[model samples]
Target: MLKISSDQALQLVQQHWQITGEINDLPSYADRNFKISGAQGNFVFKIANPNWSYADLDIENAALLHLVHTCPDLALPKIMLAADGSHIIPLNLYDDAGNTLACHMRLLTFVSGQVYAEAAQQTNTDLASLEYSLGLAIGKLDRGLSDFQHPAMMREVDWSISQLPGLIDEIAHVEDAEIRALVQRHLHYFADNESQWRQTLPQAVIHNDANDYNVIVSTVEPDGDHAQQKNSNQASAHESDPVRAHYQVDAIIDFGDMCFHLRAVDLAITIVYALQHAVDISRVKQCITAILRAYQGVHPLSEPELRILPALINARLSQSVLMATRAFRKNPANTYILVSQIGVHRLLRQFEEIGADELEQLMLSAIR
Candidate 1:
């Protein structure tokens, strides 16, 4: 699902280069790729063929291009526009257009970096560095994009949070008691905190999907211990563990899911996915602190934003369920759905495990 063999991409590349007098090698990559390297150096050309139909990715292209020019300090991709001023290769809308052609396709300069997922396989001290680096990187990114005044590129789709209240009715549809209880409890949790959560904050542009897997860790000393070890996610996360060794976060990847949302929403997305995926919760906290400190260091949170962190956690807990249910809604045999199921359960169990005092303490730690 990541690639296309269409000559349209190749033709587009050559046309842009021929017109601009830049040369490149045959683009190679997984999924839809126009990746190239040669006399013109390396450049990465990716696409955005999303689930959104009817001119969806076009708006995303606009948003990305806007962000690229908006943040001068950050290294985001630049679009390779066609000669006649079209973003994609002659995006011809027709009968069954959304199905034949994606909502939009794009190109970006290739950034050289390593992924944190691979880093976890290397050294034992990489986690702290990764966390801190992520904090700084995202803090900088968030700050750089703060003045972004553009409307969101895409239309509003169903946020899983909005679907939470109805989970009580769906609980009857779920056969498993644990699953049913998870949904019911999360729904109640969101309802209890809805007032504070809703009025707490408004949406702003954020790197909504800045997962480690979407990050790249590039290096100068390719052969040094810093070679593979330089960009890593390894760590014990105990107080005794050193923190300075893992801070080499160079760049972020996968802007496909970026959106306008509250800052806590971004934090919650990071914490929710990271805590679930990480081997240790302490590492999650370390990463959270690194990112949060970096964020607040630049753009400090408001009192309301501070108040909403825990409620956002619960809000995210509710979100996890609806997200999981959506995956299963159409596919009974999909393994991906089961993964979301586990995430949904894990978030709920965590919610149920925390008492009022502990919840307050957790919120304080998160905001700190």
Candidate 2:
């Protein structure tokens, strides 16, 4: 639903960066990934699709604002909002020959970090700390957003994991029975208990995207004359100091999936997508404990908060299946939807684990 022409994207980027450069759509682009440019100091641009409701746009902005205030160590990009309460740029779309946009356009400051995913796949750079520090950062973020009130807020979507069965029936045309069954089984678990709603989940802002790639890690303190040099991704050069070797949070990017939901839900997301990919389950346990402890040191998780972790995670996993299906149906051209396929497979395996039920029980106890 968030489609923009190549030129319009470049225009928004140029306006925000305060520079002039060619803007071409990057090859193999994902739905969320807008552009990768060799602009001044190397720039990239990600714009929200123009079709989102005004309430949705507010949700995006509110998340970014919440993260910015909650986590001082993390830097969020500037949103180019203009007077009259618009995202500054017009919602312009192009069909066969011209632009035909029906929504407002948004601009973002291109972050300067490598997609940790690709770097891990390529350099094999002992990226273990990359995962841990992300945990720490989100732990900090959790404490930051907990207990905040947003009066002028968008109502969350009223859908739930239980809704997946009806959704599957609606999509009976899904010829791939495997995908169909995956949705059915996953949702069966997700929708099992339906009393807890998003708004009822101790309402707090959360970063829905906690994957390794979304985190920007760098040395906490600058070192050496080369500390400022930019790397292949064109981010600022990192330091060589060993004591400062641990990754620290530079900024949390991407606010499109921001929501007012359970603090445990964010943890569930980080566990499934962010931690599962790079670390072993044992290390994942350590990191989870460390992050939770760190978070508790600040805001202190209530008994109810801890009990719902397993279910929150299940809700997230099932949501992934639905969102992925919608992404594939809507934007067949984007490759990002394909990545969600990997997440779906991961979730199924997670549910099959022997510890799965126990973890759910522990989470329930924490809530009690």
Candidate 3:
């Protein structure tokens, strides 16, 4: 893979896209990303990974275009065209060995708002409120994708919930023996229940990667007058009452992992991330219930899907921990991959104590 330099990125943006701006590198798992700010507004410049085939990029671009037309209400990033009216631009670069490499690039209008992960860190916001809003957003996104289809959607990918059982070998990459054992337990559960889940759940085009970092939340300013009035109404309220920040789902980003999968899989992925930072089991249950209720409000989940969700959620967390462990071993210095490692461990331990049967009943009752 050819590493893109700052100078080359700026020149590519200015000369080819006709956009001039201060380009800053953005963190990414594989692809190179830069945010360009100019008078026209901010845009994201993405250089596709060399391993990505033309078919992969084609499906991602097509999905973005389809969303633009069918779901105008969504705050999805809009793809910008090059001077030649091409959605994707090809670039020639030389690697360290002095060999030329073919690289693909594209531009997208940057969506504004704080990423949910960052916002959650700064606010004492209600967990249920945030989960409810996120559920509705994912529900609407999946609904928009119901009629949309592409050949690439059927391609086998490691991130799919169906592929979780196959990742048992990756557990060896995890350094912690306890964590590895926990992952193995979840894998066994998934293998035991795989047949029933496959037969019962409805599959569809799902936004398979709605992790907190990919979901953006619009900022909300606190109202002093309302706060003062509420405090006065409650005599026990003290001056130390923390001002809570409210948030709404602004946009969903990162479609690289989108695919045709069980409809409940999307919910499971979202729930795993939502519960990542949670420490209290009761609070985790509350957040999960709120998310499911809000999602059912938009698109009701079937009983069997709800029953299978606990296993799916466990599998998703196991996948995250295993993948993060592998990435850390390969590039130990990459902090981005390790961001959720601790939180995932905590969540898995808590889930084990709570038990899958009990959790499934809680989730099913939430929608009922």
Candidate 4:
């Protein structure tokens, strides 16, 4: 794969999208991305991995356009068409060995906000409220996309929860034998239950990668200024009572992982990330409940879906640690791959202690 440098990315953006700006490289798993700021306003320039087929790029672009048209009120970033009026720009880069590398690229208006992951770090923020907002936002997004369909949505993706069982061998990459064994046990559970989940859960076109990084929280607080002022007055009246800041979900980005799958998989992915850093089992349970309740308020989930959610979540967590472990083996110096390893292992152990039956009961109770 041809990795474009900051300079190359800037040039390509200027050439294809007619955007002239100072480009800042953005962190990516397998693609080259940059944040461009100029007279045309801020835009994100993304170059798809050379390995990605034209159909893949077409589906992603089509999904973004569909969302923009159908859910105009949503804070989804607008896809910027190139000078040629094409959503995707084709590029051919060369490796040092002079081999040809073909890739697809696109530009999108930059969604201005703090990433949900970063926003979660602020002590003044109400996390329960934020998680609720996240659930509601995702529920609405999924509802909007319910009617949308594309052939590319069925593309094979290793990260898909359905594909988690195949990664069992990756557990060998885990150095800690105890952690590996735990992951293996969960993998076995997922494998054993996969067929039943496939038969029961509600399926739809879902934004599969709703992890913290892709979820953007707008800087604008959801509570209006009146509420803030009221809270401020209360705090002034009693110095001990502090005002907590409430935020809203600004936008959801990165539709590259969008796929045809169980609607619950989206919630499972979100819950896995939300609870990754949870301090205790209670907090983990609380986060799950809060998210599910908010989602149910927007889009009620069926009991069968709820029953299989815990297993799907475990499957997602297992996918994370296994994939991270595999990536770590390839690039030992990359810290991003291991970002969730510690938290994932902790959550897995807690889940084992809680047992799947009780976990399902907890989720079922929340939605009820």
Candidate 5:
């Protein structure tokens, strides 16, 4: 990951896209991101990781275009093409060690909202509606991507649920013996059932990672105006209305992990993150029911899909902990890598207590 200075980012945007804006550096796991505020409109300028090739970036752009056309109501980031009409541009960048590397650059329209993690803390936030809205958004996103395809969609991504078997070797990195055993049990279950899922489950290109930070939340008043509106009149109305705002998932970002997989895997990923916020098993069940019911309202789930949710959710949690463990090992100073690991051990235990058969029944009842 090469670092791009704010000055360099501003210069590159002006030189290539012919647009100028004040650059605000944004934190990213691998790539460099800058929020560009200009008179025209705000946008995100991205410098891709050196490992990303043109095909990888193009596939993502193509999918966004497809969704923009197919699902117009959804707030999705549109890829901003360069002056020459290319979505991707190759540029040579230098690291601190003075090594030159070729990387791709992109510009995208910025979609604004408070991140879900931050929004969940507000006093007036409606957790049930927020969970349902998240489910509906993912359902529509998966449906819009059903017909979309590209050669890169077949690429093997490390984060895909189907690749859980590969991470089994990395489980040893988890220091706690109890947590390591829980991860081991789930990985074994995933390996046995993955082949069957590949054969029977409906497949599609999925957003894949819908973690709290990747989702954007916005509040809509009963009068239909959004909280994002800057009108002083609207602000006063919201303050005086005595009505609670409805929290909805307005946008999903960070498609870097997008890949082709079981459509049910997308729902499983959603359930796992939603459960992360739960205080107990009862709340976990509530979150699962809310999401599954809302999702089925848009795209119905099959019996087999419902049955597999418990195992898949467990497998995803294991993947998250293992990946965070490995990344934390490499950069011990960055404790943020282990943030997602909080309460994961307890969540996994809750799942075990519920057991798979009873969990399947809960999902079955949810969709009914």
Candidate 6:
């Protein structure tokens, strides 16, 4: 990864866009991203990875612009046109060797809110409302993207669930024998069921990576009386209320992983991350049901979609664990990758013990 300094990013923004602001680096795996704050307001400045061609970025920008029209009420980042009146511009930068490198860059309006991963950590927060809102927002996103099409949406992506089987060899890289076998079991299960996984299932453009950090939720301030009542009803809130009473899904970020795929695969990816904090099977079921129940209200899931979820969810977990292991081995000092995989092993084991029959029944109960 080429390190684009904050100074270089600021200089690029000044030259390309009319707005100027202080720039700070944002975490990115394959691209350079920064948050710019100024009088005009905050915005995201992205320098594309050299791997991403102009056509690839054009497809993504097109989808974002399309969603603005299709789901106007949804809080999505709007693409900001550069001073040239183009949404994307080519820029040349020099690496450490002083060789010129070409990259495409763009500016976007920043979507505001607490990231779901951080917001979920607040002990006083209402998990039920947040979980349901997460599902509802994803459901609407898929619905809006249903009619959208692009040549690049079908590009092969390494992180996609459809690529789970291709990662089987990576399982050996898992240090723990038991964990390695567990990953193999799920990957094998996915291979066996590959024929049915996408058979007759609805396919469309989906925000495939709904990981906790990529989605943002807005927190609602509780009035004095509401706060008092919330304390009293904390226990029952988990069972009764399905409304967005405490928190609401404000934005879904990082369109880098968006692709054309099975719509249910999108929901399955959401379920995997939604259960990251679960300490037990009961809590897992609670989160799963809340998401399913809310999602069905917006876009109903077919019988086939519901049945394949356990496998897809497990496959995704397996993918995460395997990929994390490979990444950690290469960079032992990056503990964040290891930290992200904390509860995945436990969740995968729990799902294995629950088995497909009962898991399917549990999901059925949600929509019933």
Candidate maximizing TM-score: 5
lDDT string, candidate 3, 1-368, tens digits: 46679778989988778998888998886778999998989999998877777777877888889988766766999989888899888777667788877878999999989888876666466444566677778887877777789988898767887777777778887777887898998888888977776677678878899998999987544344234323322122232345665567878999888888788889899988877645688768867876787678777888888888888888888988877877787888888787758888888888889997798798888555
The digit string of per-residue lDDT tens for model 6 on 1-368 reads: 66578988888888888878888988887788899999999999999887788877988898999999887757999999887799999877666787777889999998888888887776656776677778788888888888999888888777877788887777878876777888999889988977665666788888888889989888765445334434432243343444434677888888888787788889999989889865678878878877787788788888878887887888889989978987898899999988877789889889878887899998787567
Residue 318, model 1: Cα distance from true site in angstroms: 3.7
Q: Candidate 2 regions off by >4 Å?
A: 1-47, 80-87, 97-99, 119-128, 147-152, 156-186, 197-201, 219-246, 278-287, 297-299, 322-343, 360-368
Q: How well is each residue in 298-322 modelled by candidate 1, as lDDT tens digits?
A: 5666656755665666666666565
**Candidate 1 local distance difference test against the native:** 0.56
- Tell me the whole-model lDDT of each prediction, alpha carbons only: 0.56, 0.54, 0.78, 0.79, 0.82, 0.81
lDDT of 4 by residue, 224-290 (tens): 6324433422122232334666677878988887788888889889889888545688768767776
Q: What TM-score would each prediction reach against the true structure?
A: 0.74, 0.68, 0.87, 0.88, 0.91, 0.90
Error of 3 at 88 (Å): 1.3
Alpha-carbon deviation at 97 in model 2, angstroms? 6.1
Candidate 2 lDDT (Cα, whole model)? Answer: 0.54
Scored by Cα lDDT, where does model 6 land? Answer: 0.81
lDDT of 4 at 147: 81
Off by over 4 Å in 1: 1-8, 16-33, 47-55, 66-70, 85-89, 92-103, 121-125, 158-179, 191-202, 219-247, 340-344, 354-356, 365-368
Tell me, by lDDT, which candidate is best: 5
Over 1-368, each residue of candidate 2 has an lDDT whose tens digit, in order, gives: 34566676666656554545656564422233454456344444544454456666666665566667766765656554444445534445544456564555555556666554544443323234444455557777767666555553435443323344455442343335765565566566556644445445565666667766666656443323123211211221232334334344566666556665556667777666654453344444443444444445455666666766666665666566666667677887887776756755555454555266666554443223
Q: What ranking of all candidate models by TM-score puts the best one first?
A: 5, 6, 4, 3, 1, 2
Question: Which 10 residues in a row give candidate 6 its minimum summed lDDT?
Answer: 225-234
